[model samples]
Target: MATTASTTAPVSLASVTLEVADPEAAAVFHRAFGVDAYVGLRAAEDAPADGFRGFTLALTVSGPATVDGFVGAAVDAGATVLKPATKSMWGYGGVVRAPDGTIWKIATSAKKDTGPATREIDEFVLLLGVEDVKATKQFYVERGMAVAKSFGGKYAEFAPGTGSVKLALYKRRGLAKDLGVADDGTGAHRIVLGGTGASFTDPDGFVWEGEK
Candidate 1:
């Protein structure tokens, strides 16, 4: 019997898709969070992954993970696989549930490329809770966040696609619910002001600051 050659290459962490009641709102909040520019804010559907000019973070709309292929690959690498891949409502390729139950999906389509790609990470995100959605939205807008789009009244998105980092300001109650937490802003729900940037809290009780 002849042995077949292995052709399957490993998958990289292409995008981290977060499922929220309002994609637009989430987008706006993320822009304020200072990660919009980090991922290049280009719709994955609009162009090829390479079509993106500057990438801060990529967003892939998919279900959750509920299998071994995705998480297994991460584990194979040096990083510890928090959760096994599995099915989810958000529609991630494969969801990797973190130890804290924070669902994280792995990219199944993106492959490791050997090109002159600039991979310089200058920002990170810190999730927070807000009581008022409208006020929170305005706060970031006033701060110079460009509202890319709005999904009805359910959500709004903002981000400087070609700038420094991005930001995401979301409804406290809704965001907490998605994180499988209560609406009381209880437990570990403080937004992490990454790096050494300035931070502030919103009217809805959400805290944020720029990276230093």
Candidate 2:
């Protein structure tokens, strides 16, 4: 009998769930931050998580004013400022840690506000910090994920497909430095990704289940 290669459909991120101690509070914060629609909250009071969670949910917006708007709203919703919104060589952005311990980064490539500030999220990116970018990249590729961009062994981004969230990979230590957090964590990531394909866990231990 002849054998044929079995191929899996490309996985697209459909939803993101963050395990929090208080789902109500987390929902309120996300609502205030104007990203409630993008992220889902689940109660997990005993989920062991500390320091950096090995990932960051990034929001790409229109301009500086939008960046400031999101960061300010996040701070007012009880999030701690890790990096203030400021213009950098690349663009303007800021980092915040939600009360539930999820790190978020809001940014834009435009230094100036093109229009009035709005709570519009142009792009939602889930950046996973992995030990080996090349290995992880290959892992996803084998799973049918197409690489949208690649930079040697430093970073790799996958096509979003029909999902709302874009997925990317970065070096663990480098990602920590970018978020201004120490790259030391030991516990559940407390984050779950919903995919269009079968449930599976990535090489970095990130959980991905069928979309609900």
Candidate 3:
């Protein structure tokens, strides 16, 4: 007789929910920022969270113009500009802290605009800043996630797998430095990830709940 092996379904990020004190206000800001479609808002306790929130939501666009456009819209929507849109060795991008305390990064790989900037997002990524990248990466892998890219202990990106938001892991301190913020934070992450299959908390305290 042949024995059968058990297999588990791969875990994918289905939705991202930002727990905000005022969902209505957060929705308005997200709408103005042009990312309302990518995130969900829910009412949460107005917990005291200082410094970086241990994560960032990044929007990848087409060109520099689009990057600037998104950043401008975010600022106009009452977000504080952490980093102005500028061309760097890797790309052109900027960082903004939403009115609800979520940090957002809008960036583009293309240095120049080939056409007019449109309200289009190429990719929505949730980068979790963890204390141990390798350990967390292994945790996700053991839970049936396939690694899309890995840079040793520094960074790790997982396959999106039909999910709306791509997931990645980065060192907490390094991620905060990249976003131009201090790495000292307390209280809840104030974000929830909707995942397919069983729910589990990651090593870094990021919560993932199975979608209903």
- Report how far residue 20 has shifted in candidate 3, in Å: 0.4
Model 2 quality (TM-score): 0.94
Q: Tens-digit lDDT track for model 1 on 89-159? A: 43333333322123333432323323332222223332333445466566655554556655543455655
Q: Which digits, one per residue and each the tens of the lDDT, describe model 3 over residues 1-212?
A: 11111237777789999999899999999999999999999998766666778999999999998998999899999999999999999889999999999999999988888999988999999999999999889888877889999999989999886668999999999999999999999988999989887777777778887755
| Higher-TM-score candidate of 1 and 3 | 3
Candidate 3: Cα lDDT at 128: 98
lDDT pick, better of 1 and 2: 2
TM-score of 1: 0.42
Ranking, TM-score, top scorer first:
3, 2, 1
For model 3, give the 10-residue run with minimal summed lDDT: 1-10
lDDT, candidate 2, 33-84, per-residue tens? 8988888888875768877889999999999999999999999999999999
Report lDDT (Cα) of residue 152, candidate 2: 90
What overall lDDT goes with each candidate model?
0.36, 0.89, 0.89
Clashes of 2: 0
